[model samples]
Target: MALWGGRFEKGVDAFTQEFGASLEDDKAMAQQDIRGSIAHATMLAKQGIISQEDCDAIVSGLKDISEQIADGTFEYDVNDEDIHMAVEKTLTNNIGKPGARLHTGRSRNDQVATDIRLYAKDLTRELLEGNVELRRTFIDVAEKNFGVVMPGYTHLQHAQPVLFSHHMLAYFWMFTRDYVRLTAAYEAADANPLGSAALAGTTYPLDRAYTTELLGFDHAIPNSMDAVSDRDYLLDLEYACAVSMMHLSRLCEEIVLWSSTEFGFITLSDSYSTGSSIMPQKKNPDFAELTRGKTGRVYGDLMALLTTMKSLPLAYNKDLQECKEGPADAAKTLLDCMAIASGMLSTMTVNADTMLDQAHKGFTAATDVADYLAKKGMPFREAHEVVGKLVLYCEKHNKGLEDLTADEFRSASPLFEDDIAQDLDPEGIARARTTYGGTGHDAVRAQLKEAKAALAADEAALPKAPESK
Candidate 1:
């Protein structure tokens, strides 16, 4: 019989049962549900709602079911409707009337809310650790290539010369912000909702604070209705995952571009690449492409949840069931993407020589030339026009900016000296940028130090994992 079937004469339709079931999705929260049940049952016993023997039996029965679930020996009945019902039915069968008494002062509304919060807290920690590990990998790669030069792009065209380390550190900061967002989501899920009791305060003398402490929540949620109905915490998590996946997608797009023959900036390791069955020379970045593709799925997850919550008059509704799968899917997808991307980045080879060779081909130093003239008292606009004319001359003559002689440079600008040759070299141009956040060697070193400190701070802020045996 259904938990709410006592007042009803007719059973739910078979089609409705199949259509409304969330067992497959909510099954992932089985262990968390058991944890919440144990805490709730103990609280009930303390309040004298159930006997001590009943509390002990409920706890013992839940443990036995948890072990069976862990070992894949527990049988899940679809007729029970969802994980909550399945577990409760199993508990009742195992321990008789005491298992039934476990639901004395609560409702599935608050119960599932508590279970998901606990699950989110645990998963957020895992993602935080994964993010920290990914940042460390990026820093490791940057440290090894600090002085290496590359062309920085604006609008897909090379605009300036920058240290390779500086470029990599840009991604490091993007991911660090992702970690912050995840931590915020964790904070959102930290409150306990176990004693909310179906959108109202229960008449029983239940100690919500004690149950909160038992379950490791920061505190009990103050409003029962909001506690049962508010899934904004899950939204925060999905939004965090969506943004994190977008960042990863951007990085993956760059990885795909870099590995192409036209770019040749980096080559992914064979282990991370795939080969075409027909094309003999194909070394496809399938993993990076998949990461890029999966980004849309994460965005979809976020949108699905947003749409699900838009029209619901809440306090607790079946529509909230639709909210559960999205954040879970988003979190899982992002975690997998992060792990794969870190592997791709750590194992990929940087083709420094190829990057350096191409760095100057697109007039990457034209801005530096303009900056040089501007420093020599020419107005920046005037200097920019002067450099543009020089570039036009070089292009018309089928020559490069570097192919021009000192006299040619003087013809373009009277301030040009033989030192212009030194400035024209891509490496020298990159190193000449000594501003605090510039792509110069010194600037990149300072950035590295700041990045390492930021990384350490994030690592320090992560919640310690629950101790395992």
Candidate 2:
């Protein structure tokens, strides 16, 4: 018989049981469910609803079940429906009457909410740590490549020359914002909802505050109905995961582009690349491509949860059960992607020579030539037109601006002097951009220092996990 079966005369059909069971999906929350039960039983004892002896037995039985679950000795029955009922049934079987009292002043509605919140809090801490590690990897790669210049693009056309380190630091800031979102999600999940009972306050006297403290929650939920029905915390978590995955996808897209023979900016290590079954010479970035593809799965997870909660009424509903799997899958997918991407980045060989060779081929120094004329007292608009004509002439002759003589430069604009050739060098152009946050070497070093400090601060903010049992 099910835990709530006393009111029903007939057992549910097999199909119904299969459809309604959440045991497989929620088994991961067994530890959290046990922790919430222990706190609830203790609160019941403090409120005089259950005796101290009963609390002691309940806690002892729960601890034993926890150990069994951890050690793979616990037998899970399909009839149990979910981890909550499985643990409760096991407790009742072991401790008899006192185990029955463990549910006093509580309902599965509030209990499940509390369990999920606890689980979210722990997962949030984990993801925050992962984000910090990934960001550190980015910083390490950037610092190592500090002065390497690359062609900066607008609409896939070369617009300027930029330091490779500066380009990498842009991703650092994107992920740093992702860390902030994860922190906010953690705060949302930090409140205790255990004492809310089944959408209305419990009739028995209950010390909600004591349970809140025992479970390490910031506070108890203020209203039973809101507490039981709210899933905004889950939404917050999925949103964070979705946004973080988007950032990863963007990086993966760039990896795919950079590793191509056409770009030749990077080569993935053998461990991270795959060979074509038919084409012997092919080494494909399959992992990076897959990371880019899986980003849509995370977005679907977020949207699925949002749609599930859109029409529900004030209190707990069976539909909320559908919310669990999406966020769990999202979390797992993102963590795997982040770890693999970090490995790929840390191991892959950067083809600095190829990058440098291609850097100047796209006329990357054209802007510097224009800027040189603009600085020499020519109207900026006129300088831009003059450089446009000069670029046309160079293109007609299949020559670069760097191949032109100083006399040819002066013909375009007398403002161009003999030293104009120096201004056309890609490295010289990149170095002249010393403004803060620019692609200049000095600016990139300062950005790396700032990135390291940000990483350290994020590492410090993650909550320490409780000692494992």
Candidate 3:
């Protein structure tokens, strides 16, 4: 059932057949292949390159094959070089001459190029949907824990008090950027490449435009050689996935640290946790660790294709076959990791008391104490040194800034007042940050409103799928 070896006296050797086959990777694109064939056959008939009778037969046979592939009844052969050959050989065997005519204005090179674009369009949309859901989940988590206080860190040292809602919304914005990147990847994959026809334009009056519209692409690719060889869309997808995974890994790293006894800031749900075999008390955040580790894996996928395409001469090579697996793996892995993240987030317990207790330690409100003195007409630099001496005195005496008497505060600076105690309260300090995008309660609520609006707009901007396969 080999389709392109009519001139050869004998077939490839058995080992070579297995070694060269892409059935495992190509199987996922079976429906995309059928859809492209239908569009090509329809265009052939429209331009009078093939009879309408042949076009109808080809469409009908392709629809049946699509059903068979979907229903798990299609027989796949190991020696079928790729999915394009697999579908074409089956169609020719089942529907005879019209199926043979389906390849009139195309090559496997351009066919697979088109298939990858179609697959990318679909995959990108799916990833976008998951991305929106995860952002929404973070928003929900933030609103649920609104006004809860936590210690913000610089270099893992508590630097200021911030609302927990503000921290979660930080991730919402990170994923918002990821949504933009994924949208660009979809746009890159939206161009059609069907009529490239190997490396040169075909002699037939092949209507690439009609197929482009029929297959729901933005436009036909302008050059045959670039159309057949360009895999930049896959690179875009892999890059998006890699960056998104990096963001996810950062968040998961925090979760891993937060769930530990030293932090006790949060606890993961048992559903997303794993138990130690012998140590009964162990509830390991294995999934979070896996997501962090897989960020490098997605990076490898992007780099592998980049290395493969680096030295090749233009216009399709066997090395181009290495492109599909990386984008596919990275996209699927990113989607799965996002879902896991959302699940862990929605189910995990927030230790509010522990977080607030920790918020009070490390002199988390020290910045606000300096701000108070500065607002009371002291130079910021002088106020900073005054607070520094007070902090040292407290460290020696094993006391907090709040534990100092009013006279003791006045001895350091005449600007100190009894109301300075309010500045040292972590909750009040966090709420006092009223600037835009700050950690104040009002500021976070406004930020949450903007996040919801952004999510809604991006989801609406997603491309509408055509009704066909």
Candidate 4:
């Protein structure tokens, strides 16, 4: 007979068992389920709800089962319905009556809820580590290309020259925010819901605080109804994943463009590149394209959980069973994407000369020219118009602003001087914007220093190793 089958006159049909069982999907949460069970058993024994002998037997049995699951030797049954039952059944068979006492003060509702929170805590830590490692890569790449000038774009047109380090630091800040979000998600999952048995508080005198400490939860859920039904932490996790994926997609998009033959700003390493099957000349940014494409699936994961929880009545519903898959998949997918992205970035080669050469074309110096005139007592708008006309003249003459002679500049405005030639240099143009947070050499250096410090602090904060079992 099934664990919950005593009330039924007959066993469920095989098709119904297969259709309703979550063992396949919930398999990943088996360790979490076992962890929660051990905590619950310890609490039950502490409160005298069960014998100490029984609690010890249950804990020992659970640890053995945990080892079996970890070693890939545990068998799963469709009749078990979910990981909770699969694990409990295995424990009961391994330790007999004592293992049967393990679920005395809990329900599948609270059990699954606790399991999900534990899983979320583990996932959040992983994502934070991945975020930190990827940010470290960004910092390394930025330092490697420090003060290298590249054209900053607006609407895909060259707007100005900026230090390549500044470009890389922009993403560093973006992912820093993602780190904060994932941390918040971790905080959200830190509460223990183990004693919120079935939706109402358990009557078994279970010590919730004992379980909280044993399981390393920050707090016990204050409300039983909220405990079993709440999945906001998972949502927070998925939202973090979605936003992080979006940022990765943006970076991947730039990588694809920068590696293109037309742009030639960077070259992806062969390890991260895939050649066209038919064209021997083609070295494709397939990894980058894959990262961009996988972003939508992460978004879909977020939306899937949101749609599942939107209208379900509290405290627990069968619909909630569908919740685990999205976050599990999202976490795995995001972790893989981050690792691949870090590899792609660390191995890629930046074409500094090509980037600087492109930076010099398309009137990139026009803004600096206007700034030059404005600084010389001309109203900025008037200076902008003068520079615009000069750009037109240079274009018609098939020359860049750098190629224009000082005589040509003198004709446009008396404000133009010998120093105007210095402003026309792309490197000089990039160096001129020394405002705080601007793309000037010193500003980029300051930013990189701050980034390195941030990376150091983040690395210091990471767990030194996996938590000791």
Q: Which candidate is the best by lDDT?
A: 3
TM-score of each: 0.98, 0.98, 0.98, 0.98
| Pairs clashing within candidate 4 | none
lDDT of 4 by residue, 275-391 (tens): 887999999999999999999999999999999999999888999989999999899889999999999999999999999999999999898899889999999999999999999
Candidate 2 per-residue lDDT over residues 384-446, each given as its tens digit: 899999999999999988899888888887788888888877788888888888888877788
**Alpha carbon deviation, residue 443, candidate 2 (Å):** 0.8
lDDT of 2 at 38: 89
Superposed Cα deviation of residue 412, candidate 4 (Å):
1.3
Name the regions of candidate 1 deviating beyond 4 angstroms: 466-469
**Among all windows of ten consecutive residues in candidate 4, which has the lowest summed lDDT?**
460-469
lDDT of 3: 0.92
Error of 4 at 61 (Å): 0.8
Measured on C-alpha atoms, candidate 4 has an lDDT of 0.90
